[model samples]
Every structure is written in C-alpha cells, then in structure tokens.
Target chain A: MRRILRKHAIVEDDWTLDDAARTPAGLIVPLARWRAERELLLASAAAIGVLLPNTEDVEAIYPQIADRPLIALQFPTFTDGRALTQAVLLRNRLGFAGELRALGDVVRDLVFWLGRCGFDAIVPRPDQDLEACRGALDELSVAYQPAADAHAAVWARRRMRASA
Target chain B: MYRYDEIDRELLKQRTAQFRDQTRRFLAGELSEEDFRQLRLRNGLYQQRHAPMLRISVPYGLLNSAQLRRMAHVVRKYDKGYGHFTTRQNIQLNWPQLAEVPDLLAELAEVQLHGIQACGNDTRNITCDYLAGVAGDELVDPRPYCELLRQFIALHPEFYWLPRKFKFGFTGATIDRAATRTNDAAVHVLRRDGAVGYRFFVGGGLGRLPLLGQEMNAFVPEADLLLYACAILRTFNRFGRRDNIHKARIKIVLREWGVERFRAAIEEEYAKIGASAEGGQLKLLPEDIGRMRGHFDAPPYRPAGEAAADLRAQAASDPRFAAWLKRNVRPHKSAGYRVVFVSLKAPEQAPGDCTAGQFEALAELCDAYSFGELRSTYDQNLVLADVAERDLYALWGRLDAVKLATPNIGLTTDIIACPGLDFCGLANAGTIGVTHDIYRRFDSLEAQYEVGPIRITMSGCMNGCGHHSVGHIGILGVDKHGEEWYQVTLGGSAGNDAAIGERVGRALSRSEIAGGVERLIRAYLELRSDEEETFIECYRRVGMEPFKARLYEAEGESGKPVPSESEERPPGESGQGARAGMARRGVAAA
Candidate 1:
C-alpha cells in the first residue's frame, strides 16, 4: 500500500501494475507487456506508463515512450546506478518529457541524485521516510555538471558573474 | 592553487550539510550499514582495522602552510597524533571517530579543503606532477586545469557512485612524473601550433588487473576537455560490470570490449553529449578559463644570485650535505630557487607517516623557506617548492634536527609500503615490518647511492594500495595457509617507460623475504653494465633469465628456476612504449 511521490507531493496511484488486468483508465505495464501490447495500450488507455528493468534495452522502447505519461525505471539494487544513465539518455537522447519515476530499491538516500538524473517522483519502498526524502533536493546548493534538473553549473554561474 | 568562487564555496557548504545529515541518519539507525557505507566512503571515510580512516583531498598535491597547520590542529584534537600521506597526494588521518567526522569535514572546508570524492568508487583525487609549476623541464603548468577539474568532479551528481575507484593524473611535463599511465583517465597536455590541447587515455588502473590506459583521443581541444572526460565516465557508468566488485573497474570494461570498441563507444557517447544541451553546459567558458589561468601568476623570483662554486665547495667539504644535495635537491624553473625535498622515510619509521610534531615542523619550514606552501610527491615525500639556493644550508640544520633529512628520495631505503595488516582490514600480511627490514638492510647511504635509481615498492595484498604491481622491485604479500608470505616482482615501472613487473619466482616466507630481495639486488650489482645503468636498465637488458638464474642458483625446485609470470610476453616484446592498442600515435612516450 506504498503510495508514490510526484512533483514533490504524495499521489494516489490507480494504474494497473500487471498484464493480467487490462485497465482502460491507466495502464502502467512492465517492459514485456508493453512490448507485446503496444497497439492495444495506445488505443485504449487514457495514460500509459512503462516499467523498465535495470537490464532492459531502453532503446527498443524509446520511440513508444515519447507520448507516454510516465516511465518507471526499476533499480535491482540501490547502488547499481544503471538506471541513472537510462533516465539521462531518456531525457537527453529520447526527449521523454514525461514523469520519470524510480520504482524499486528507491530509498531516501538516493532521492537527490535520482532527481538530478530526471526522476521527478520516487516511488519509495514501504519503510522509507516520505518526508525525509524531500530534504534530499536541498542537500546540495549547486551542481557541477548538467543533469536533468538543468540547473546552471556552478562554473557557468561564476563565469557570468565574472563577465558582468 | 585555484581559489574557490562563491558558488564553489556554497556547493561545498551544502555538501557538508548533506553529509552531516547522512551521518545523523546512519547513527540513528535510519540508514542501513550497507547503504551508509557508500555515502561515507564518497566523503573519504574508511572503517579500517583500528578505527575510521578519513582521507582529505590535496588537489594535485598543492597545499599552503595554513592548511598544514589546520591539519595539525585536527590531528592534535582528534584520536591520533599522526597522519599518513598517501601515494595519490591525499592526507589520511587514521583514527578519526565516526561521529566527529562531520565536524572535521566542516573545519576542513573552512580552509578550502574537504574529503569529497577523496575515496570510494569515484574520482579519488586529480593528482599531477608535484613540480608542475616549478620543474624547469615542464612545458606547461598543469595545476590550473587540475584545480578546475578537481572542483568540477567533486561530488559530481552522475559520478557519485562509480563502478570502481577512478583516478586522474595530469602532466604537462615531458617526464610523466605523475604516473599518467597508471590512472583511470589521464590527460597529457601539449601545445601544438600555438594552441593548447590534451591527449586522453582511458581504462588504466593498478589494483588486481594492472593496465596501461590506451589512448582514447589523440587531441581534445581545451573547450571540449571536460565533455570528453564526462563521456568516458558516463559510458563506464552504463556498461561497467556491477556483478563482481573486483572486475568492476573501467579497465575491465576496456579489456572486455577491447581497446578499439571501447574507444568507439566513448566517442559515440561524447557525440551524444555534444549534441545535447547538457554537453553544452559542460563547456569551459572563456571567461572561466581566463579567471582560472590568472590564479597561477608565478611568484616574483629573484635573479640567479648564488654562486655554484660556494655550494660545490660546501658539498666537497661535507659528504653528508653532498648526499643530501644529490638525492633531495631538484632544479627549479626559477634559477635561484631549489625545490628541496623532505623525505618521510627515516631508518625504522613507516614511509609517509607524519606525526603532529613533524607536520608542525614542516609547516614552519614551509612558511620560512617555501613561500608558505608545500607540495606532496607521489613517492611519499614533501617538497618545499620555492626554497632559495642560499637557504639550503640553514634548512638542512632544521631538517636534521627533526630527522627529515633522510637523503633518500628514490633510493632502496625509501620504500613505498601501504598500511597493510597493521591498520588495513583488507590486508593479509604486514607491510611496515617488511619495509623496516629492507630499510635496515640497505641503510648505508654510500651503497644506496651507488645502486642508483632502484624503486622498490611493497603492498599488503593484491589490492595494490602500495602500488607494488608497478614498482621496479614490487613485493606483494600474500597469505598462505594462515601464514604471511611475500612475492617478489622485478622491473615494474610507471613513467615514460611504464610496464607491469613480472613475478620472479615462488613466494617467500616472512623470514626469508628481505634476503630474497637482497639476492636480486646482489645479482643486479654483479650483472650491471656500468654505474650509470640503473637496476631497471640492467634488469631490462638481461631480461629475467640472469636474475632467475641467480635467485634459483640455490633454493628453487631441484635447484632449477621456476617459470616466470612474463614468459609469454617478455619485456621488449610487449611493453616498450605500447599500451592497449594505441601504438605510437601523434604523441609518443619520452
């Protein structure tokens, strides 16, 4: 019964999680189900969400995820960090502007980099502190490289100030 | 030294606060031990055999006197009275309490120093030639780029958790003193057609799988430097092995994919990043580069005022001073200044271990003679980077009082040993004891100077924290049946002539290790072409056959030599200026 945090707030998740149920309202399907039921999904569902495992060949589903409302990347382990690149490529390469949600192994500690890498909402595990996860955003005042948050890098800001 | 801008300071402050919060959570049982381990290690905290070891960043080995005093203050207030300087140009306080680390980090931040990315599976430190600015042979000073890149990689969001520890070595000198061939990604800066650029090498590492990083790009323009580095790291993050911790280094990825395929993948990743706005953000702005370049205005050097005759006469009168001058003194870019090296290896003392008293003394010497600054060498020594020629006689007096004048910078007694079983939880055998035994055997100043330029390094285990795999005479300690044993490797090097040493024979017991090392040395002394030919040069010319013949002239199986580790790809066949797949590209090793 763990809920999802979207755009900095908790939201009720009503999407169907498995392929056994075909929901007309919202369909959040795994990688296999989405690959097999692509036509049925786009034609029927109001919103489409695709779940990608850490090992999923994301380029295969890149074209289909453009108009999708959500993309949930599962982390087999918190420290694996494979999904971070997926999220980066999704935003930078595939141009997926929808909500990138981190699904499994989502803990409070990873919320900061998760947001930086384009995950807007982290669907944390049951025991995580939902309120404490919000504090991760404020952890670092500035970033060095360009990430999904798209905040100006510290060096760029310094250059601007120096020029002025 | 790059000064921190407002944004840089702000980021570090916020980073400290973030770590403080993380520490509070871990102590409160909110974060699991396994989860907090990565977080703490990224901040340079390692739970060692005795207590938590905190390593602070010394970017490119440059530090001012004020930072040294603050380090002394922390050492005095914290658990231990001593600290260890690592081969990667970072200072490690071995016994810091886990709870007080947050406060220590804050104090360190006040001096423009912190442990961010100092350890863990991330960019540890951006080390460079310690004599970058001062070396007369250097083409360009690499500190400005090193400083900029150090800040850029500090707590980089995407690179926070690397597959394995990443290291960068930058050198603008022809000498390759920074060991560029042994780091994860190394950049050698060169000026061509009046334009400055870098040659990039990737996947070089030393731990279990030693490799000389192959060249990825022949030339990356100054504007595209950071982007190129980012691309390599991104590709490594995506494709590096996560199944096995030991095989997770970027070198393994390069080996598995082969050099050409890995190079193509990095170039493709770079192209993707360049086509994106994120890559555009990675550009080093013109104004930013100019500002960084302005920080390194050289110190006002006096004219060449000291007489060489006076120094030579003094050396002739005093043999001790002559030995010190030969080993400890190096030429400086400024004619009158001598880059005086202070050796940390004394008779029985562990290499690179500096007590609080030594730190304070060195700080005073640095303030008086070195324009209040000091640089740490990868050879586990300190350099007063701006000592005047006239001040050496007086400086020797102060150094002599503190036993800092060991007169062995790269000699046999100046051995590099890791904090092996004595302090490291990962270690199987003791390294300091072996170092002590070797130092005691080769204690004579005259004999060591006679056997010139012999680099012997030892490590506790296969992790190679001591960089024993690349030592000219590498000794790796192994555990056999719950007993300590040591293996000897000959002719390993990290320089213009970089190669992984080959194992000589079978492992020796603790009692016979020193004698085994002496036997190899005796063989080198006997077989060397002349006095000028170093141990490595002689060893290289003779290959392993003569050394093997001498080593097993008595003890090996049936009084016959054992098969060597490098029989398949001997010395000249494989490692002469050849790395991975890059064969004498636009730039060649010196």
Candidate 2:
C-alpha cells in the first residue's frame, strides 16, 4: 500500500489504480475507461472512482459525481496547473462530497495549494517526504481570496475585526 | 498607501520565514536548481548575468516616503548603492547576493513591503496609472480596485502556476496613461448606467508576438470584478497552451481560438463559478471597497491664492525654468497643486538608474513637496504628484541640483532602454551603449524640443521589455553573426490608440544605428506638416514610404526595397523573451 498525506496526516492509500482488463471494484479507472464502461462499472459490488486527465472538461465529471467515491486529478507536472482548477470546480462547483485525491507530480511545494483547492488526499511522488508534505499544509494561515478551504479571506477577517 | 494590519504583517512574516527556509534548502543541495529557480522567482529573486537581482514590488506605482527610504536602505546595504526603475513601475536591485535576499526582504517587511508575486509565472504586481487620483482627466479612482485585485491575485491557489507569466494593468482616466492595453489583462474604470464599473480587455501581450488586447466585456459590475477575473484566469489556466513555450501566453490561446470561442469558453466558466456557493464569498462588498478607498483619500491641501500667477511670472523670467515647467510639469486635478515629474533620464546617467543618495534625496523631497508620497511612472521616471504650484520654482531648483530635472519628459532624449547586454544574460546586443551614443547625438534640449513629443523605445532583445513595439520610433537590437544590429519600427502608440509598430527597413550596424535614428528624426523634421505634427502623427498621415526613402537614401544605397527579416529568416528567430519571462517576470531586463 502507498502511504499518502490525507487531512494533514500520513495514512495508507487503499484505492487501486487503472487495471482496465480486470474487475472495476476498488479501482480508480481513467476517465475514458470509466465513461466507456459506465454501466458495467455502476453495476459492480464495490464503489468506484475515476481518474481525470487535466485536459478533460471538469464539468463532464459533474454528472457522475454522486457515483464515485474518489476523483484523482492529474497534475502531469508540478508546473501544469490545469488540475488545480479542476479540483476547485469539483469541490466548489459540483460540491463533490467524497475524497479528492491529487496524483502525479505531487510535491511539498504544491501540497499547500492542493489542500486549498479542496484536495483532501495528496499522493506524493515516490521520493517526497511525507512528513514535510504534511507540514506544508500549514505554511500560511492567511489567504487573500476565498478558496475551497474553510478559512475566511483576509477581507472577511478585517470585517469581523471591525464589527467586533 | 494601505496600512498593514496584524493579519497582513503576519502573512508577510510567515512568507519570509518560508522563503528563508527555501533558500537554506537550496543551498544545502536538497532542492534542485530548476525547482529552486521557480521558488526564488516567486519571491522576486533572479539569477542574472553577474548576480542575483531582486525586484521589489511597487504596487500600482505608489510608494510612501518611509517605504522609499526603506528601499534606499535596502539597496545601500545589500546592493552596490544603486537601483533601476523598470518600465513596469518596479525597482530592481542588481547586485544582491542570493543568500542575503531573505534579510533584505525582512528589512523591506518592516515598511510593510514584500516582493511576493512580483516576478513569477503567477500574477505579478498589479499596476495602475501613476497619476491615478490626481490626473486632470479623472474617472473613478482605480487604486482601491487595484488593491482589491492585488490581494485576490496574491498567492492565489488555482492560478498560481499558469502556462506563462500573467500581467494586469488598471487605469481610472480616459487618457490611458498606464499602458493598460499592453498587458495580458486590462481593467479600465468607467461610469456605466450611473454606476462605476470596469471594462475588461484580455489576451494582450508584447513578447515575440505582439497583439493588442481585445475587449472581452463592455461592462463588468464592480461587485463581480473578482468573480469575473477568476473565471477568465481559470479558463486560461485550464486550456492555455503548454506544449510550445513560445506559444504559451494567453494571446496565443486567443489567436488559436478566436475571440468568439474564447468569450464563449469564458462565459461558460464564469457561469459555473458565479453559481458556486464559494463564489458568493468572493464577491467584493461595497464596504470592503470603501475601506480600501479610504486609504487613498486625497491629502488635505492649503489654499493657493496667487501661486499659479506667481509661477507663471517666474517662468517668464527664467528660460530654463520655463522649459522645465513646460515639459516636466502637468496640471493636477486639485486646485492648488501641480503634477511634477522627476526625470531619471539625465544625460550623464543611464536611463532609469538611480543611486542610493538620489533615492534618499527623493524620499526627503517627497516628504517636503508632495505630502510624503511619490510614484514611479511606467516611462522610467518618478512623480511628485501633488506639488503646490507656488513651490514649483523651489522644487525645480532642488530637483535640478540632484540632476533629476532634465526637462525632457516625452522628448527623444527621454529614451527607455532596458539593462540590456550589460546585465541581462539573455540580451544579444548592448542597449545602454547605443542609447548614450544617441543621447550625445541629440544633446541639446532645444533640438529635442524642436522635434517634440516623440518616444524612442529600445530593447536589447525581442522580448519587448522596453516596449519597443509601442514606441513612436522603436529600435530592437538583433544579433547578426555575433555582431549587434538594430531594427527600427515606425508609428506605434500605447495610449487609447494602441497599435504595434511596423518594421521600416534593413537592420543597421552598431556604428550606424545612431546616425540612422538621426536620419529618421531629420526626415520627420523636414516632412512634417507643421510643428504641431508629432512624429507619430506625421508618420500616420504620410505613411512609411517617405521615412523609408529618407532612412536608407542617406546610406548611399539604391532605393530598391530591402528584404524583410521575416522573408529571409523565421519570425522572432530568438524568442529570448520567453526564457527571460521564465527567469524574470514580464519586465525581464530592467
């Protein structure tokens, strides 16, 4: 089992990755495979998850939000930021209630932002330090804009202080 | 001059601590050079030709005296006692060591200043008109909107790592003094339906590919500004090109997908974001805007009974002061005040380079003359935006003593040249050397005034950091067989009428560039309809044939047309601007 940082703690990941030829139970299949095998995957005994490519339209997965227990968004590279918007849309727009996992090119530098973008679980690359990745979540306590994270923006904080 | 509360101060403190640790890790060989480069670039540190240059953010071109003094102190202590003001209204220290940048940033934090998001692929500094509130032609003040946008863009989670660097410029006036059209996104304030809103323009940039911004929306309500911006940036972050580095800017995305398709995509994204529950939380409240506006309220002014009349009399008596008054001073919106420009383009010094002593002196002068406030213009000059009319003579005297009153604000001598081959490792040719030669050729103020109201922009590379594409006479330095040659572009403007200049003729060698410029100007002087016909105006009316005929004719060559660089070689053969933008921000060289 691969250990990942979830909610600021290191935990073992139970979800299995793409094995299109085998049964879809407990496997996070790619978006194309899941779309093609929607009926077959829906009839499975266990809950299924989908792995979304960064280039795919985030809204395409919205209709299937309730059926999946996890959505692993691809980062592709640390500098490729298409998945950040995808995660935000999934959490804020579609109101995805299940686990939001960040996969591929996940590193300590991007871990804080991943959490803010509503990614609950971060699958760090093979060489990344889990402890450091966990600590990166608390890098800054203040945010200038309201993100998927629960923290109030600085302007809201200012308003609260003024009201007090 | 928004004051920082505990939350703001704490945020800066935490950011400094994080960057300090990042620096330590890089030095310890824990982080790779590529990763460290990206990390340090977010904090405005660049590994330049000789040293690590630090670009300090001057948000919207506004700075208080204390902050200016802090900048002087930082430059004096860490750098070689000099800093360069860039065309984007930021100050860059060229000689700071990489190890000591954390200390420098901490010192700057004392004055509530940080270089955060000043130079990176993320949203850089949000810029506004230097004369935001005090300009004669005024609309709603844009500073508060800029502040709000700056806050929202700072350390944004979803848009931090875009395909390429992004820029935003705002202007309150109808004059378009901030060069808003040249930025990646432009927000102009206007009153629509009895309410102050913004007109948003997108996909404008000036690198190897220069394209003017197209209006995306005619009117975005004030409350929906942040939401609309997020929608646009989100669309760009998701779909902008990442395959080819040169084609990564938002402009290319707009080119590939036409404006109609781009607008449809943005509207779809905007609808999704606006319907999101969290999006409501991002809507800017009226009280929030009011609070930010209170920070920029005009300072109290004393009465000015006979100040203008007395200044006029003084100008009539002193010719030098009259020249300075005509060129360096502008009318202010306030009754008793005038907008004063402190020209950094003195004949003796490199354009935009100021010494430590000059910075300290400017801070003191700002305190004495302009209500303890000063601004940096995108034209590489400084402004005392609120000087009283009665104090014009005294201010001119003081500025003259410090070599700041050159009386050449928009003249040919007021050249904008980047820290080209001297400091920028990406530059192919030298800009400062050629600029000084051009300065010697046009040495007289009377001569420059005779040929009036012209802008000459030069860049050592095709990055267009010097904004050569929008200059009246643009000179771009190209490399030919390891020797420096310059290509001239004619008839460009950056104001409300923004247009990319057209390349005029063949490239000139290093020795021939200055004389070629002289011929271009001399042609204008000879062919102009009247003295009122500015260089751009004359060029627009008479077209390029007359100037081209004059430029190459004097070289003793036949009048046959020379093949363009594009016909011979690939367009923008180098594209050094992308690498420079990756290393530095938009304003790469200086």
Candidate 3:
C-alpha cells in the first residue's frame, strides 16, 4: 500500500473530502471536513477519525460519534494538551469503546500522560523514535491519582486497605 | 475562621507533594521550560523582571494573628522581610530563590495557606470586601460565598488551563468597596423580600479594556450560586475567544455574546444541571447564616469609659497626639471600641510595607488585645480589629515605640502610591518619588486635614494600581522628555457612586507638583460651602477650571507660588499639623 500523510494531519495544503475518503481505512479528518462529510464518510468507510478543535468542541461532538469505529484526537501543539485529555473523557464518560489514538507533535515523555488520558496508540512525527516512545508509557506502573485511566478516585484510594 | 477538616488537609498535603515532584522533575531536566513555566505559575510562581515572585493566597484577605505571624516568619526566613499585598487580596513576596520555594510553600500549607491558582490563567484568589463581616452597613456577610467560590475553583480539573486568568470578587454592601466592577465576574449580594441572594455581573475587567461588568442575572437564589457560576464557566469554556490572547478573558466573551444571549445560555445550562438542592449545597438557611455569623462574633472588649475621656483630654493637650487621634482612630461599631489603623507609610521605608519584625510585633498586639484579626485594606493600610477602648492608650504607646504608628491614616501624607517604575516593570514613570515630594510639601497633619479628606492617589501608569481614577485628587505619572511628569485629575470618587476622574489640562513638571497640589487645596479652602464638604463634594460644586488655572500659573520671586504661602498656615491652624508633618518627612523619604 502506498503511504501518504493523512490530509487532516498535514497543514501544507487544503485536502478535499474525496482525498480523505480515498486515502486509507483508518485516517483522521479535519474537524470542518469531518463534520461536513460525516454521513458520507460513515457510509463509505470502514472506520472514521476526527481531529477536534478544542476540548469544548470535542464535548459538543462526542455524543454524535459515540459508536464510531475508531476515533483519533489530534493535539495541534503539545503545549496545550486539554483536547487530548478531553478525548479520554469522551471514551470513559461517553463510553465510546473504540480505538483512541493521539496524533500531532506528540513526543516520548508525553506517552505516559497520554495513556493515562486513554490513548491506546500515539503517532509520533516522522523523525521520532516510535518504539522508544511507546516504551516510555510503561516506565511508570503506579499512578498517584485517578485520571481518565485505571486508578480509582483519590478518596477511594485513601479508603482502600491492604490485603491481610 | 473555617477550620480545615481531614479532606481539606489531605488535598492541600497532596497538592504540595505533587508540586514538589513537578519541581524536582523540572530541576532534573525532565520537563521542558515552557511546560514547567505553566505548571509553576499554576502553583503561584511567576518569573518577573528581577526575580521569581511567589503570590500567596489570602483567601478573600482574611487572616488571623497566627496566620499573619507565620507569614511574617516566612518572609523573614525565605524571602526579603516584606510582602506586597495585591489588589486581588493576595500577598506577593518578590524575592524568593527558586530552590527554596517548595519549602516556602510547605510552610504556607501548615498555615492553611498556599499559592495555588494565584498567578495563572486560571481562577485566582477570590476577593471580597476587607471589611466584610465587621462593616455595619453590609446587607449580609459575603465571606461565606467568597469562601465557597474559593473552594470550588481551587484546583478545578477542567478550568486548570484557561486562555487568560479569571478574577471574581464579591461584596455584600451596596458600596462596592471590593472593586467588583473591575473583575471577570462579580456577585453583588442583594436582599429581596427579606431574603438575601446574589446579582451576577459578567465580563467586567480592568487591564487594557477596563470595561465595567454587565449584569447577567437579576438575582441568583443563594442556593444556585455555585451551579450558576459553573454553568457560566462552562459557557465561557465553549465560546470564549482563544485565538487572541488579548481577547481571551471572560469579559470579551460577554462582549461578543452580548449580555442577553450570555444570560440565556447560562440559564439554559443551569436548568439542565437540575438543581441538586442537597444539604449545604444551595443558599444557607437563615439559621445557617446565623451560625456562620457566630464564627465572626466581635471579640471580647471592655469599655474604657473615663479612660477614653482621659486619653482624649491628653490628646487634646498635645498637638501631636491630637493629630494622631484625628487621623488614625475610627469609631467602632461596638460601644467604647475603636478601629486602629496601622500606617505602613513610615519614613525611608517603602509605602505600604512592613518589615518581618514589625509584622511579628503587630501579630503580638493582635493576639494580646485586637481579637486576633488583621485586615489588609485596598488602600494599603492595616486594621487591627476589636481594640479595647481601655487599651487605646497602651496600644498607641506600644505602636509608637515601633514607629508603626503614623497618625496620618486618610490625610494628604497618607498618599496611595504604587511601586511605580522602581519596582513594577509595567510602569511609565516613578510614582514613589512624586508621592514622596507631595508628602514633603504638605508635611503638616494640621494642613493635611485643613486641606480636608483629599485622596491623593498616584499610579505610575494608566493601569491604575493606586486607583488613580477614583482618587478625589488623582495623579497619573506620565513620561515626558524622558523625565517624569504628572497629569492631575480632580473630582473622582470610589464610594457609593464610582466615577473615573477627569484630567485638568497640561501635565505638571516634577518640581511644580507639590506647589500645584498646594494651589488646588488653597482653592478648596478659599471656596468651601462648609468645612463639612469633603474635597470631592467641593470639587463637584465648583468645577476643575479654577484649580487648573491656579496650578499652572507661573511662579514668582519667592521660588514658589505666593498664593500657596499665603494660604498655608502653621501646623495646628491647618488642622493636621503634627501628624501630617511626621507623615510627610517619613513618606517623602520612601
């Protein structure tokens, strides 16, 4: 299969709906294009992905695509990770139960927080070390508090007693 | 004072630990500078022009004697021996080494204080009127609501990252002493049908735009206060501008959405939340309010009676004591008690500043006689609450010993001045020097009170740190010829009806400022309706033209204006001679 950067992931040029529809089985689409061709994309594709503009935008649109096959959240920049965190909320609270991937400028150190925030897969930039980045997520086994991941609430943690 | 229960204590302990870990990682080079910057700011550390400034939360500016003592200890041990009280009711210690900050924070946590959310693009320390519980004219004490908001917003997960900092202030009194108009959102407590509730205003802000808040809700029943606030935050999270940092505050959102639409959105979200109405969730019941009121009961005080009479007689006998009594003492709401103002404008020291030693002394005084309460006012003065009438003489004697007792509380030498260009990076000119010069010129307490109730506030720039816009006699330091020149404004008031002061034509030269002020006061003295009319009322009755013309008039042979000299009487006749003279000499050196 020919490899091409997903139109939504690249900002060099404007990508049409046809370009995104023909690209691959699993690829993220720009928020505007995703919303515009959501029904058409849903009818034609095996899985659909969307890049949210912000946490608020994700909240407003999460319910509409709760049962979608695969959802990918793109962090426009690593500086503000609020949207990526909100993607975790969409999966945990709204019960999306799908492949949750993180894309766009993500690095090795952020993998742990990304996992805690419910990202199963992270797409690093072309030049970065993907395997090492993935390994970074497993470096810490015990989390201090319950985030969007496996740990319980802080109150619950305090109440838990050790096994006899 | 609200005691921290187990949950509150654990939360603070854990938060401090988390910040410590974060600091460790940043020092170990694991976290990037940008990432650490955001994290550190969330914990109330800011990289200012000269050093790392840590803003300690005051929680609506309420502090007990013990808390203050701890703060003083922190200043002495970790920081330089002083802290600057900010407009938002927080305290900023300007010089703390980055390495020692965690220890400083750990110390703060022990006193139920922390720097969390104090200097970030998050909800900052919730401010309320400094005189909240004690003010006689208050409809209800707004501290409970302020406390509730403080707890609700502190470390809120969703709002941890915002486009810009959010500020909220509450006032129970009709007089908006808390500067509610200059906050992101303000709750004004209003009474309706014998029940107290809140009126919500949104998008009010001070920096750059300086727009007054617009009323978003006519009345929010006390029960729905937090829920409604959450809804508004959610709405702003969704719609507030993000692309532009300047336009990112809630104020801009309200402006863009318009008041009507924003209100409708908040109300719609509020209805969806479906009034949880759980116990302790909504407005406090009358009994609950009364219980809270019990927490703020007046501390034990004994009537001085004849002792106060004797003190008054002694004060009258001594001109210095008389001046001090007039300026420093205020009638207490309680019988035979008085609110003693501790002036921070001592000579050669920074105005509105106290050394750690002075703070400890004040704390000792607070513990001994003043009901253990200390208040930091917006005018940068300190109030020792619940002073016994009998202890007045003794307290004055002790305060005088420390040089903390300057008897010019609201007089001319008791000038409200900013750090100006000397300390603040955002200043255009130097306010401290100008204020000093003015203090030197009108040094007589008798002359100051003779001038009568002149609020001479100065700001280095238009940001108005000294609240120049509301000063009866306002001076804004403007830069001309690369030298500092001051623009004077007359007839502004921050009381029941707040008004921004108007400029009186040309800016005055640095040398001519004191003379200019003297001329203006001379004009007021000459054209008074009665001695009862304050500087504000007098300016209102007779417009700024007369004062303006007199001020800018060319000086003659005496090296100063003849008008100023003729109007100037010796100290006692001026009504504020002794205290004013002391304040002028003291503060001018500052």
Query: lDDT of each model, Cα atoms only?
Result: 0.81, 0.85, 0.69
Which of candidates 1 and 2 reaches a greater TM-score?
2
Structural similarity of chain A in candidate 1, as TM-score:
0.88
- In the range B1-590, model 1's lDDT, one tens digit per residue, is 66776777887898898899899989999889988998898898988766898988898998888888888889988857888988898899888889999999999898888898887888778989988888877877788788778767777767776677889999998898888889999999878787778889998988778889899998888777788888888888888888888899999999999999999999988887788877888888667777887887777666777512266877898888888988999888777778899999998898998888888888899898888888898878888988888888888889988999999998999898887766666776778888998888899987898788888998877788788988999998776544566788898998889999998877776777887788888899999998888999999999998887776555743443334433222111222212311221222222
Per-residue accuracy of model 3 over B1-590 as CA lDDT, tens digit each: 66565666877887787678778878998767876887789889987534788988888777787788888999999887988766566778878888889999999899898999888678888877777766667887887777656666766544555667888888898678787766788898878998778898888775445566778887888766766776676666556676877788888877887888888887876665444321123233444445444556656556556324456677877776666667887777666677788887765555676778887888888888687878776677777756766787778778888887888787777777776655554555666777777777777666877876777888766667677777788887665434455778887665556666788866776677778887888888888898998778888888988888787775442353223212222111212322232244352321
Q: List candidate 3 segments past 4 Å from native.
A: A1-26, A55-164, B256-258, B274-322, B479-482, B512-515, B554-590
Docking class of 2: high
> Each candidate's TM vs. the true structure?
0.93, 0.95, 0.79
When sorted by DockQ, best at the front, the candidate numbers are 2, 1, 3
What are the C-alpha RMSDs, in order, of all predicted structures?
Answer: 7.4, 3.7, 8.9
Ranking by TM-score: 2, 1, 3
Off by over 4 Å in 1: A22-24, A57-60, B306-309, B553-590
Better by DockQ, candidate 2 or 1: 2
lDDT of 2 at B232: 83
Q: Candidate 2 chain B: worst 10 consecutive residues by lDDT?
A: B577-586
